[model samples]
Target: MSQPHLSSEATDPASAALPLRRVLPAFAVDVALAATLSFSTLMLGLFGWAVWRGIQLAQQHGGAPDAHALQAQIGTPPVLFLIVTTLVSTGGTALLLYVWRRRATAAERRESTRRLGKPSTWGWALAAGGVTFLFSSLMSAGGRALGLDLQPSNLDLIREGFARFPVFLTLFAVVLAPLYEELLFRRVLFGRLWRAGWPVLGLVLSSVVFALVHELPGLNGKPADSTLFLILVYAGMGAIFAWVYRRTGTLWAPIAAHILNNAIALAVLQIYGDAPA
Candidate 1:
């Protein structure tokens, strides 16, 4: 009997053409991979702490302490481990891009930049804003029709936190969030899907995923209101962002819009002191 052959060519080209298929699977996989890698990194850090503690214990009492004692001493948030893992992943991606650049022709580099760095039109921003308003209005109307409360929550924590850390909040809202979120949702997720030719599907799928990611623990708190409704609202917002990115072929417009929207929302919450239930 002939040996079985495994090959990339064996995969369906149609599946490859549908970027949504690739993106959805990759999104799921990435989340799982990130969690696993983060946990592993945290465990490694804890092990290093235990070993260090062993040396300290040996110096004082000639032996390592019990595992229970070590666990108590080394207990710390996994945030540092997550940060380290993110840095490693980012560095690795940069290194890979650098390696690819060394081999790529000048024309290829120019084309790559042309594709990635194109500026979006002002009209695209207007369209995005319009879409956002319409979506928000529709959701509000739906909530009213269903007799569901559709008011913004009192963002007391956010308001207080921002007051305490104005500079940090500004940096996070205006700079960090726009840059990272646009890159992740627009450039990577949406762009990949658009390139694969499932522009509409990719737009919707990426938006939903972006909204869910925002809801994950530590990044943001769980919604007290209906999670489904919140997801729909966020997904709608994500669609607007994706549409802006798609129409303009530039990430800056969507980033600006996102930043502006967030700043406005924050200001509203601070001024009005949250909506009454």
Candidate 2:
């Protein structure tokens, strides 16, 4: 499921005519796949830990660990949980992508090769990343001007998580998250909707959902007053990703852009050490 380098076909009418319904993964299938992955990760991670603890306890005292002991162990040494969950999620996503690609139609395979064979695909992806940074910065500045505290509430959680498990959090942010996210938001939501002849609706709906998912967690420990502004900012970034995908005619375009954007954020977090994202 690969296409030849047809660099000039980036804007070809035939490329636009590719049957996305036949090429793109079904929305319902993606949703079900995501749910299955999530459930599997949780079950496997927790069950594995429980069994290990039980074995250790049995060996030590000829009985399983008590509930309190299990609870204490779960959080005291979190390395096992973190590693297991990360491996499951990342590996599962990769396997799913491989399966989908293997099952793709010839037209589906061609979707990514139209313009992506040239260096210009990376150029467009990087441009999208840059635009997203500028747009988000401006949105934050404007919110402050309007007397809204638009600080990202997830920053503290991210910092804490990184402190506890740097490798897992970094991998999740810079790679795994972007892969499935771009697939769902850009490819499934926006691309499918646009291909179904609803470009405007696709753009707006996908952006809005993307924004909500990114910003809603902030509500857990912060004021809800800035939620609207933060959502708008993130939605704008999502829109930029969608725009790049549309412009480049490949899902990889947005995936690359998203990864770049997150990698930049990770770098800033590293350099600034406890600074807010």
Candidate 3:
């Protein structure tokens, strides 16, 4: 009896090269759908809050509220929108992977899970805290040398939000973040790139894209100095995360590391209320 030949679809090259034309379109469609749903949800939530507050103010004072106060309240929508977008994008990506690609077999995923040795959770958490502190300090020094302002304004926001919603903040920072980020950045994008036979280029490209997605240009149609500094920092962090994932061949390690880093930042911000200059 002759051995059977493997099917073309089962071949590595054919499996990997799933045509950018088809892949890109599907990816774009999913992202657009996610954005639309997230934006709608954000708008409804913001509108409801605004209406509630307006009614409360009217009941108390029997007149319209101060213009500045109203504006400040309205200003919160954009930030909320960003948070919603992050959640929806991450969730949508995971759904897409499950429904479409079926990228890794069950066995492969199980093996990947097993590869992530059971390191002490607290040790990882402490190590991640040290890493974040050292990296942030180094980045801040570089920014200062370059005449750039790299303030910890985002850290302040995280601290304030955590104080207000401690349990929710913990869930978001520790669980949702690591799971979604690892799935999107490591399993989906990086895995695809690596299989395409350009591991190094793929790593850098994905990291750059990750950083760029977080950036927002200035109101006057110019990029902010702080934004540039943040992009560099985020990109470097992405590369580090990618390395961790690749080395372990398991998403758990990177996810744990990321959660630890964010949790540490939250702790520091709460304790120190932003690092001193």
RMSD of each: 9.7, 5.2, 7.7
Clashes of 1: 0
Clash count, predicted structure 2 = 0
lDDT of 3 by residue, 98-123 (tens): 34553565555556545644464335
Across residues 1-277, which tens digit of lDDT does each residue of candidate 2 receive? 3432212212333434445575344544554565577557767777787677667766786666677875675453265355457557645654464456223345655766756786888899999987777687677767788887665765755676688888878887788777767765666566555665556666887788778766775544546667877888888888889888777877788888888888887787789663222
The CA lDDT at 178 in model 1 is: 56
Superposed by TM-score, candidate 3 places the C-alpha of residue 239 at a distance from the truth, in angstroms, of: 0.8
What TM-score quantifies how close candidate 2 is to the native fold? 0.69
Choose 1 or 2, whichever is better by lDDT. Answer: 2
Which sections of candidate 2 miss by over 4 Å? 1-36, 54-62, 76-80, 83-87, 90-104, 118-120, 140-172, 215-219, 226-229, 274-277
lDDT of 1 by residue, 55-142 (tens): 7765675566677775676555343343344444433332332232212334433443464444445556655755665576677667
Q: Please list the C-alpha lDDT of all candidates, in the order they appear.
A: 0.55, 0.66, 0.59
Q: Candidate 2 vs candidate 3: which has greater lDDT?
A: 2
Best by lDDT: 2
Enumerate residue pairs that collide in model 1. Answer: none
Taking all chains together, each candidate's TM-score versus the true structure is 0.58, 0.69, 0.68
